[model samples]
Target: MKTMFKKHGPPPTAVEDATFRIRFAELSAGYAGHPVLHQLSAGIAAFTSTALVGPNGSGKSTLLGVLAGVIQPTAGKLHHAGGRPPAFVPQRGAVGDALPLTVRQTVEMGCWGARGLWRRLTRQDRAAVDSALERLGIADLATRQLGELSGGQRQRALIAQGLAQESDLLLLDEPTTGLDPEARERIAMLLTELVADGVTVVHATHDLDAARSADVCLLLREGRLVGQGHPRQVLTPSTFARIWQPA
Candidate 1:
C-alpha cells in the first residue's frame, strides 16, 4: 500500500543559528556491536519544539535516548548548554503499569532526581507536583490508578511527571501515537505552551501533522541526518519520498 502522506519539493539547507540548547557533533551510537545512529551533527534550538521524523529504524528513538542521557554515544560528543538533566517521557508501552502507582505518586516521582530517592518532598516539591497535575488538567485524576486511565489520560499523567521535573529540556518518544485526534491535539497544544514558557521539547514521531507543528524538523534515514530546518520548508514531497520511499 502507498504511504498515507504526500511529499513536496526538496527542503532548503539548514541555516546555522546562534541560539541552541543542545549540540551534537559527529554523534554516533549503537547497541551491542551494531550501530543504529551514524555520525550526526545537529543543534536543537532553545525554547522551541523540534520533531524527529523518519521511517522505522531511522534512529529517532536512539537520538532521543542519547539526549536523555540514558544511552551513551559510542563516538562523537553531545553537549547541553543548560548542563542539567532533561526530563524524558518514553512511549507509554515502555512504562510498566503493573506497579499500582496512583497518578499523584507517579507524577511526584519526577522530583526524585532533585530530592533524591530517600529525601522527603518539601513544601516546594509538593507545590511543583500540584502545579504539574493542574497544568496537564489531570489534578482530578490524581488519586486514580495509572492503569485505570485511558491512553490519553495516561499520556497526560506522564507529561505531568515530566513537567514536575521542572527541566528546561523535555524529550518524548512518540507521545501522540495510538490516540484519537482530540488527544493528539491536546498533547500538541500542551507542547506549544511549554515551548512558549522557555522549555525545549524534542519528540520522535512518525506523525507528519505533528511534525509540521514543530518549529524545527530533523529527518533521518538509516541513522543518518537527512534534513533539518523548518518543517514546512524541509519536509517537502521530494524529501519525504527520499526518506520514506523504498529504494
Candidate 2:
C-alpha cells in the first residue's frame, strides 16, 4: 500500500516502446463496482513532468492509485519502466496530523518498503532520510512535530518522505492545492528539478499555471483521455472552456 502497480499480464495490443516510463492501455479502476477510469489509455514519458488536468472527479486520484500500485485495476494493462514501486506523496491533508509523528520519523517510514515496518533501519536508510530532509530544505525541522508546522512546511515534509523512498517514479496528488503563490512556485520548481534528476513525475493539479509548466499534459473528461501533449498544445483556451464550462 505504501508503494507500486498491477504490471503483470501480457502486453496490450497498443504499440508502445521503452520511451514511456508508464503505459496504461484501456485501464479501468475504482471503488467497489463503480468505475472512475474508463478504459483510459496513456503513456507517461520518462524523466518528464506530466500534469493530470481535468475537472473534478475525472479519475485523477484513482489513476494515481493505480500507478502507485495501491489500487488494483479492475481491467486493462498497466506497466512501469522498472517494475519498482513508485513513491507516492498523497495530499498533505490526507495524512492526519493526529499521529504525533516527528518530521524525521515520518520521512523514515519511506524506507519501510525496503525494510519491513518493524525492522530496524540501517545506516544507509538513516542517511537517505537525512538527505531527503536536506533536499526539501527541512533539515532544521526534522525534529519538529508534524502538526505544528505551517501548510507549506508540512507539504515539504510529505514530499521529503516520498524522496526518501528513492524510487525512479514519483506520483503526487494536488501537491499545490492550498498553498500561497510563493509556496506553490517553490514546490513547482522542486518538481522540475526532480525531473532533471531523472525521476519521472506525474501530479494531478488544478493550478492551470502549473499545468502549463509541465513537459506533458494529460487531459481527462468523464474518465477518458481527451487530449495529451505539450501543455500549450493540449491546454488551449478553447479546450479549457469546453472542459471547464458549466454543466
Candidate 3:
C-alpha cells in the first residue's frame, strides 16, 4: 500500500515565499476501522514552533505519525519544503525498558537516516552522535541504559536522537508529558534552540502554556483543523470552550 506522504522536487514557486515548511490538504487516516483525522488541511510555517492542541482523540499523534511517514494515511495530499522527511521523536516511555541499548547506542540510531543501519559510523557520524548527546545534556549518561534514566533524561535522550538525525523539521509527540515543571521548561528551551538553528518544530501537547509559547498554534477538534495562526489568536478562551467541552 502506498503511503500518503510523498517526497518530490522543490515546492512550486508560488509557495516559495509563503514561508510554509509543510503543507497538506484533504488528509485522513484510520486505525482498525476507527476514523482519526478527517479531511484536514493545514500548513506549518518555516523555521517556527507549532503546537497541536486539542482534547483527547483530536488526532494529534495520528497527524504527527503521518508527517513522520511511520503511519500510512488513508488519504492526503502533502508536501514538505525540505524534500527530506522530518525526524520524529516519540514520548519517553515509547522505548522499552528491556532493551539492552545504551544511551549512546540509542542516539547513534539517528545516524541511520544518513548512514544505513548496516553501515559503520564514520568519524563524522560519531561526531554527530557526540554533539547530539552534548546538546541534550546527557553526555555524562552516555553509558546508562535507557530504562535506567529518569523520565526527563529519557526524553532528552530521545530528542538527542532526533537531533542526530539532523533533519530540517522535527515532530515530537508530547515530549514534555509526565515531566517535572523544571524538566518541561528545559525541554521547551531546547525546542526553542532548535528553531533558532533553523529547524521547524511541531509538537502535540496538552500543555496550554507550552502551546502559548509556539509561533503557530493548530487547534484540532475531532480530527479536523479548527484554527491556524498566532497562538494568542487561535488558543482563545471561547475557542477552548468549543473544543474541550460538549458541543
Candidate 4:
C-alpha cells in the first residue's frame, strides 16, 4: 500500500490558500513489544473528508489519536501543514465521570486553546461559543447540563466544541456510533457542511455505508492499508468478504 500511494507522489503543499493540509509519510505506532502499523503513508488534501474503515483493532482510533497529538507515534512522520493544531472528538463514553459542567461551559472550554492561563473569555469568545452552539443545533440546550442531554444531542455538543476551536483539521473517532439512522445521516450532513466551509475532516468508523459518504476511503486491516481511494473503488464484494467474513 505504501508503494502504491507513493506511485502517485505527494499531494500539493499549498492547496488553494486553504486552512491546513496533512501529509503522513511512513507513520507507525503500537505497544512496546509489538507494532500496530508498518510504514503507513498517505497525503490528505485540505478540506477533504477521509474515512478510515476496518475491522476491530485495526488502529483507526490510534491513528486519529496520533494526529490529534494525544498519542506519540513509535515511528514515521505525521506533518501538520500549518502551525494550527487539529481538534479531536472522542466517543461520548469517554466523557464519563467528569466534573459537573453546563453545555455552554463545556463549549467555552474549547476556547482554552486560544486563551492564556490567566486570560478570560472576552465578548468575542462568548459570541463564538453561541455561534458554535447554533451551528450544531444545540442552542436551546446551551444552558442545560452536559449530563442531561441525550446521546445524539451530546454528540452534537462535543462536535460543536471541536468547531469552536477554529482549527482547520478535525479528527473524530466514531462520531456517529450508537446513533439511529436519522442521527447518523444528520451528523454526516453536518460533516458535509463543515467541508463546504473549508474544514478538513478525518473520521474513523466501521460502517461501510457511512464510509462511502467520505471523499476518500482507506481500508485498513491488521494495521496495514489493504486498499485506498474512492469508496466504490476500494469496497468491492471480494474486499468486503475478506475483511468481514470469517475464515
lDDT of 2 by residue, 54-157 (tens): 99988888898899888888878777766458999999889999998999999998999999999999999999999999999999998999999999999999
Give model 1's clash tally.
4
Tens digit of per-residue lDDT, candidate 1, span 1-247: 0111122323212343337788777788989999999988888988999999999999999999998988888877666765458999999999888979999999999999999989999999999999999999999999999999999999999999999988999999999999899999999999999999989999999999999999999999999998999998998999988898885
- What lDDT would each prediction earn against the true structure? 0.89, 0.88, 0.87, 0.82
- Candidate 3 residue lDDT tens string, 54-162: 9888999999998887877777666676545688999766779899989999999999988899999999889989999999999999999998999999999999999
The best-first sequence of candidates by TM-score reads 2, 3, 1, 4
Better of 2 and 4 by lDDT: 2
Residue pairs in candidate 1 whose N, alpha carbon or C atoms collide under 3 angstroms: 7-237, 8-236, 8-237, 8-238
Which residue segments of model 4 deviate by more than 4 Å? 1-20, 116-118, 245-247
Per-residue lDDT over 1-247 for candidate 4, one digit per residue giving the tens place of the 0 to 100 score: 1111322335434552243377676778877767888767776768889999998888888888877888777777666777467888998888863559889988888888889546999888888899999999999998898988888989999999898888888999999999888888989999999989988999999977789999998788888777889888988899898876653
| lDDT (Cα, 0-100) at 73 in candidate 2 | 88
Q: How many steric clashes between backbone atoms does each model show?
A: 4, 3, 0, 0
lDDT top scorer: 1
lDDT of 4: 0.82
Q: C-alpha displacement of 170 in model 2, angstroms?
A: 0.4
Best-matching candidate per TM-score: 2
